[model samples]
Target: MTKALKASGFLGLATMMAVGLHQFVILSGGNPVPPWMIGGHAHLGVLSILAIVMGFAVPALGVTGQLRTAVTVLYIAGQWGIPGIVWLGEGFGLTFLMPTGFLWGLALIASMLIMFYVTITGDGDAGDRGPTATAPADD
Candidate 1:
């Protein structure tokens, strides 16, 4: 699961960069796209964790199932599928959705990276070693 998460993070980041760049172009008036339409479009990229956790089971208890399912939606609709739809609609002509997809994809990757980091490192990525901090009654 850790390996998978790491891999996903890399893929998601790449997607985000591409989509984000395209979105930037459209927003900067490179094409006929309007600014208003692109607004809030990048958010999809920012909140992709929900979709990323779909395949793996989160820690805790039975709650992992629900959480994973919810996460899957973002991957299916927000990160992976929506971009194509957005492009089809106005990407060719220039719209925020087109570039937004790139951002979203990048965000997805970032989320995965963050998740792995948090889960593996605990302190935002330092590697698993400090038993003194986590050990229960070992003292």
Candidate 2:
């Protein structure tokens, strides 16, 4: 799962670079930046970073087997799906694609809630102190 997340992160970064270059070209040609490009760039950059960070944090969450796999897959899908849908819907005038993107958004939200529930409920290895933080020593 860690490797998959890392791989997706790198792939997303690469895609972002291409989008950036495209934007630069458009701007250099004296045209206004399209709203879709801006939206795509923001989603791609932010979600890519989250995916990479979550790669490390997942193991600490104590979720295992199918639950872990489901979360990972859903997150990665949203990381790519949101931006891809934006490009398709707004960039190419495929308005129908826009609504489908909400499905991906829901997937991301679901994954986040699951992890949050696990962490707060002490159901995972994170324990009371949470994943990376340590409790203060007694006086």
Candidate 3:
């Protein structure tokens, strides 16, 4: 979990750098930047921070292995892959990756679902019971 959090934080820093680079490109060029590039850059910058926070929170969520893996993959895609695809597409003026937008959307949705489930279910502590429930005491 600690490693995951560190990884997320590093990604967030990288995303911030990307955003700065995007701004530099726009400001340095007389030509206008594309709206998709701007939007993608902004979203990635914000979502990267969210990913880091989520990474820190997820360990307490007690998610199953499969669900944890899903969350990690989807979060990474949302935080990194979407913006990267946009950067490449815009840089090369290629539309081949446009269809991947759907995948990015799915990744966002999956991450949200995992968070919602964890929040609602008390961090996946299945063995935990309320005050009215008690475990047997060892003598």
Candidate 4:
């Protein structure tokens, strides 16, 4: 979980860099962004950062096993898939990619809801607060 979270953070950083690259592409071409593309780019950038933050929290939040796996898959797919779809659609002229982005968007929301549940309920190894923290008495 820890490793996965950290990797997600790095991926987020990469996404951020890509966002800047996107801006450069526009500027270099001197092309004004169409209204549709603006929202897709903005959402992709923000969600990428959110994924980075969530990656850190996943370990601290202590969600494990299947729940962790499910959330991770859904979150990663949605978070990464949107930008990918947009890139394919806009950059490669794949009009079919737009609908797939919406599906990924749904996955993103599902993952977020699961994350919220884990956070609010505080499930899993509640006592495992790193090496320094003492375990509670079984009695």
TM-scores of the models, in the given order?
0.36, 0.85, 0.70, 0.72
Model 4, 23-78: lDDT tens digits are 77987899876644665567666777777777767667777888888778888788
Model 4 clash pairs are none
lDDT of 3: 0.71
lDDT of 2 at 106: 92
Query: What's the CA RMSD for each of the models?
Result: 9.9, 3.6, 7.7, 6.0
- By descending lDDT, how would the candidates be arranged? 2, 4, 3, 1
Give the per-residue lDDT of model 1 (tens digit) for 4-116: 44345456556666766777787688575444335334533543343344333333212234444444433444454454545454646655446666655664565455445
- What TM-score should be assigned to candidate 4? 0.72
Q: Against the true structure, candidate 4 has what lDDT?
A: 0.74
lDDT of every predicted structure (CA atoms) = 0.47, 0.86, 0.71, 0.74
| All candidates in order of TM-score, best leading | 2, 4, 3, 1
- Kindly list the per-residue Cα lDDT of model 2 for residues 64-83, writing each as its tens digit: 78878988999998999999
The true-versus-predicted C-alpha distance at residue 22 of model 3, in Å, is: 5.2
User: Which has the greatest lDDT?
Assistant: 2
- By TM-score, is 1 or 4 better? 4
